[model samples]
Target chain A: MADPQGSNTRHQAYFRANLTLIGILLVIWAFVAFGCGIFLAPWLNQWRLPGTGYPLGFWFAQQGAIYVFVILIFVYVILMNRIDRRYGVDEKD
Target chain B: MTVQGWTFLIVGLSFTLYIAIAIITRARSTRDFYVAAKEVHPVANGMATAADWMSAASFIGMAGIISFLGADGAVYLMGWTGGYVLLALLLAPYLRKFGRFTVPDFIGDRYEARTARLVAVVCAIFISFTYVSGQMRGVGIVFSRFLEVDIALGVVIGMALVFFYAVLGGMKGITYTQVAQYCVLIFAFLVPAIFLSLMFADTALPQLGLGRLGDDGQSLLQRLDGLSTELGFGAYTEYGGSLINIAAITAALMLGTAGLPHVIIRFYTVRKVRDARSSAGWALLFIAILYTTAPAIAVFSRTNLLESVPETAYVESPEWLKTWEDVGLIAWDDRNGDGIITYAPGAAFAGKPIYAKDPETNEPLRGEFGQRLITNDSAGDHNELYVDRDIMVLANPEIAGLPDWVTALVAAGGLAAALSTAAGLLLVISSAVSHDLLKGAIMPNISEKRELLAARIAAGGAVVIAGLIGIWPPDYVAAIVAFAFGLAASSFFPAIVMGIFSTRMNGPGAISGMIAGIVFTTAYIIWFKFYDPSSNTPENWWFGISPEGIGVIGMLINFGVAIPVAALTRAPSPAIRTLVQDIRVPGDT
Candidate 1:
């Protein structure tokens, strides 16, 4: 009696959107921590960055990832807020 | 007073202050106990959260790990701090709007099913216990090393302090105490770091200090790279290992941090949903201060260590090195007969006397500086140096030859960092047992007074258990803590996220997904962590992923099982759907 099928479809859409955003973020996060930190490190080492004599990957592995993480938090906050509003679930106090 | 005596006195006073604060701010009711009456200011909560989150590992273990791992160690710096972004963006505000005191409450209520709540409780308990054990162990190590007390006694002292505050005041007591602890610990950590940086690079800020070129015109990293390469090791700044493994471990750590129970619970303490969002931003800012300094500490300490031992003779070794070696930290073998310490690569001294030979005399270097510093090498193995990674941060001030008080400050700072985290974890575990298990499940109709009593009893009991575990830790403190984070990421993160965002997620789906995730990940960890080593064959790891990286695969499985099973299950009743809508809207209160 509660339109179970209809609710199921709606829920699927929401799940897809949440998963998509999470997937995108995960890819970028991996690229910074793993890609730049380890795999691409050798390649990046060929090109020394300004000021710091080390490769970009070395910097990414240590300082760059942390800096990106702070920015990511702000980004996640904005994106999730938008998702919540679009889904009509934004808290209106 | 002697330097050690002064360290003991100052650190002891800080503990007394923490207890006094806890006693003055003891919670009055269940609401106050659980969420600090939801009256904490955003900035205040931010500071408390920062203190709560930056555990002993961050304060002491992180720099040491980085120093040893070289480039690979950045995974922790990125992974642990990155979770705050996930917290700020994905989970915090919605959970605050749902307005529950515990994470289990949100999961159970969101799915409108008791089973979902129970499953969440199990996950919370597992994660909290694993996490708390490491924190307690950290406390004991700091106490024994700095205060010169027996390890067991140190654990007991730490246990008693945490029990008094966590049981008496709950979140209210924990919150205020954390603020105090943060101030003490951060000041203790930064002062020595600043001094060391200035000494090394003439820069007060560690972040800039590390990048500043040394007096030789080569960057500090460039110098380190040359030193390690000369010693037959990878350059300090170069990365090694498979890309996939790095990605998996980093992802696992970040997700695990985001899903951590103690951190998520802090969101419920703020007054408004908006405040939760803002507090997260502030928490990250506070955390970044230390997060950024850690790498600098790693580079500076590694450089200093190499310089101190630079191809010198055993007799010429620095005083600090000798002291640390006496404490069983640094070890070296005089491979050749020459009294001069030869730190060169390969077995250049094979079949030769204990010390390397002098080029001119072709005889053992002898006399005061020439004696074999480390005498016990029966097998004559080539790798003759042993240095514990933990000593890097512990001996940083001493290594730099800073004043004695700076070293004392580090001792106190380490304790504060460890105790604050242990207290937070103990409180989380006790609350979950009392609020979720006893009150929510077994005694739903119990009075608030009884619940409060139960919570106190639970907190006391947890402290004892954690202290015992601390006395005899199963693994090194950092490895054990990393396993806990991996478990949280694989099991809890998916469930919490899906339950909040997806209306189709049924009780059965959430529970099964969690069970599957926990079972698969736990099995992988046990097999690789314990079983595989006994056989001595090629490690039968799944998909070439080590136990450390298995959490990423486990997380995928959790999402896979949860989404499909959720799709197969019938949707919730209309009443349940309305509850979801209500949770989404913040004004229901």
Candidate 2:
């Protein structure tokens, strides 16, 4: 338990940072999957995608949401990696 | 070569590759057997995880279901892929950091209770068993259709192949073979899709082709919507199901995907916590390649099918319809005595077509139009055809008049998807029994060598049982799939999330929460699905959530019970709190 006080505070800060990032990402996730894909689909269907015939909401549900999900995970990976290093808690290997 | 010859050659060669990989990468120790000695590259592991996660349902059933349901099918597309987001963000990295051989290992140790471990083992085994039986049956179906063999014989052959690799090489064998399987399956799926896209929309990419306009100045989807309504069905782009049900079912599937023991166990094969996150990203990317294309195929195939079948003379209908009809997946009943086929939005028969057969010769009876004669009465509708949803993907190439080899490739791809998922589930079941139940409890003093032997025996036993179930498959395979996802969501997802995220969640709380969740969801499913299926209508549903979506409520109940119980009870020991904290960070231990 060397310097338990300082390390505990640092760990707390790191955990809070993680929670905030996760919170923001989850909000975006819910918005795309539930918000645009389902609830607002009818409203968004008023407009078609530019040059393509797909309604915006239908595209999100069928194709766009999945693309966003993939990008979201990769974004998480990159940001989490930076956070890991910033906290000096990254894997040492 | 003919389609049959091509199927045999390709499927045979794929099996040979898998066996060779298994022999080369066979496990030599418990670590290798359980986690591939934690040596798998993230990309390779990603491919394997994708192969393991995408079953015959995703490969064969999804596109067909989407073709039939149209926009309503977005539930599966979003539900299945969206789960990876939850897994990567919430569960995968932390579980990998804990360095466990199995999901039960983490649950039992984290809760510091044998009962908690036992509950986890039971949930894992039950879920995996239910899921694997379906995969084996899928393999058997592919063989029976393409290879012209008995379904039981196909299952036996599949069992023998799986037993060799799973029992001999364990996770190490399954992982590498799955990488090869992923390649084979994706290739098989994409080739026909690309060909169809070019023929229909002048685009090689099916995803873009779905949205492009045809010569008629209407997109494929617009034409589909028009055709569907003209045939008395809902528009193709409009979701037909209740919105609440769709949202709830999607939630259940997403949470269930993250909680699946077979899927989560794949993460343990990676070397570090970061690898877990990165591999999940890769896995979803690989899966998205097929998933995104499946809906495109659905739209294209549905448009093609509607355009070709309805109003066509039976004698002159495309050869694919007759081919599928010969196999009993397509049925034509000239309900109005008209020579032309008329499809609409109603059941062609009360259930499956009861084909009229020659009693003496025991062969199917044929009508004047050379269509198979059926004994069943029509449902007073103009619909003359009863089409099984599976033909969308299976017969897409044939419908589009693509080469016979493309059709053959679909068969091999279905088999790869089924076998890979089956192998992954069997491993989880075996590890739960041999590792958690036996080594962790019944025989704690057992040596690693004996443990490894026990695991192999358990896997062998699991394969045989799964094969038997596949041969004499229950009529409720589709219904039981709902049970697997529902139980996994209700029982494992909440418990595991609480165990990792909540420092105060104790053994009593977890055990009670799991029991409550599983019982509530199982009873609800049984009540609606088995006990009184006629009452399964939306009007009778509790809050309009179907049995498929009841897992969402069960999860809420789990959280409701767990947090309160944990609050009233004593806090977890300091060591456990520290353990939770340790898993949250990616650092050298």
Candidate 3:
């Protein structure tokens, strides 16, 4: 095991990186799910999809947000995995 | 074959598959019973989680509810699915790394108090039972309508089937059966959707079909808006409620989803922390297949119902209408006495449709148009037909003139959805009782074999109680579902989040926060939902946030109370701080 002092500093850096990543992703998460989907839905409704002619906000609320949620989780997985490796905390293969 | 015959065969085969899988993978020890021996691959666990999480409400009720609500339905569509993001990022991996069998185990250990564990145990059991009863009722509803059986008998049959696999296999049996159920339900949900999409939108994908123009030269949603407005209902795509309520309700549901014991327990079945993260993604992917399609189904069914039922002679109404009417879920009053159905915006009669019964044979009294006669007076609205929101999904196949087997498949799918969720909830309830309550507190020295037996007994007993609740459900059952989510949101979500992210969170602070959260949320819900339902409207609400959304405030109360309380009180021990740090990283360091 590494010395306690160095390990503690490494741990702090790792956690801060993880926290920063989470904060950024969550902002995007909130933006799509709450912002485009609900709050600004009426404003977005002024625009329609190119071919199908569905209101942009309506589509996001009912369909787009859900698709984005799935993507967000997978993105977190990928980024968190890389961070884990950088911090020497990824699950041993 | 007749719908009933096909329903019996398909539902029978599904049950047989579940039982066979259960017997093969039956739990042999406590670990197997609680966490499927932690060997389930992420994809398989994902499918199981999908089925377990999407209860009968999502399968049978969601589209119907959405059809009625129009754009406002996004609250449920977004609320339910968005929670997975919270689960993956804020909770699941860390919980899996903690490696406990039940949610209470984590809460109990993290807070370092028996009271905290007991509180969690109560919330887990309370929330699960509240939700499970609704699933049982869904099973009974599907059974009565499709299989031509009594609702009580349907609940009993559903109970018996769940009992076999759940008691025999525990989490192991439940996990595999849920995967099978996910397949059945998704296939059943998709076939009719694809057929309808093809017929209406000329697109094979329901998601795309929803956006495209129909034969009427309007997008399906536009057409729905026009049709609803013509009939005096609000336009289909406009939401009239306050935005704050919508946001609050969505937040409540999302946090509640992350907090649920049954859902949290699913992560523990995965082998590694990363598996928990990815499996959540997979679960949402599977769920989205249905969720994205449901709005399409909602539009198709609503448009079909409006075109076929209204402005038509009662005698010429489609076969599904008559069929559903016989089950008393659909009714017409002929208020204008024109022999024509008028399905406008208002209730046809006051209260539910109470069929006039023949005292001797117990058959419904019929009107001149051969419609089931009702005893209630007019609701004074122009509407003549009473359509239950549930029929939007249940009778969609028949409404669209699909073959009888397709209808039967829908029945089987609804049963699978209900039974899968019921089995999952029962496992959570049983594990809480046997693992957390009994072994952890009452008898720490109990043998693994005896604990396994206890788990089985707990599950079996829970099934009977759930069935009883289904058969003679209390008036508060529906109200309690809202409470379940709110309670989970206000109680478990804050406590667990704090326990993981905030190392300074001590037993006293967490305990007080939990109590404050649950008490505040509960009192608000009970006051509005039960005690003073007359004042449940927005104007009477606190800051225009409905009781359905009050849990958001309760969650804030938890956070607001917890941090200060923790700062004032002694911090957690250094070892406990290390535990928090350990769970954050996936590998040993």
Top candidate by DockQ: 3
TM-score of chain A of each: 0.79, 0.96, 0.93
Supply candidate 3's per-residue lDDT for A64. Answer: 92
DockQ of 3: 0.81
Ranking by TM-score: 2, 3, 1
Ranking by DockQ: 3, 2, 1
What's candidate 1's DockQ score?
Answer: 0.38
lDDT of 1: 0.78
| Greater-lDDT candidate between 2 and 3 | 2
lDDT of 1 by residue, B362-392 (tens): 7544435434343344455455456667778
User: In model 2, which regions exceed 4 Å deviation?
Assistant: none
Judging by DockQ, tell me the better candidate of 1 and 2: 2
The model with the greater DockQ, 2 or 3, is 3
Please say which candidate is ahead in TM-score: 1 or 2.
2
Best model number under lDDT = 2
lDDT, model 2, position B461 = 99
Candidate 3 segments exceeding 4 Å error: B214-217
Q: How far off is residue B159 in model 2, in Å?
A: 0.6
TM-score for chain B in model 3: 0.98
Q: Tally clashing residue pairs in candidate 1.
A: 14
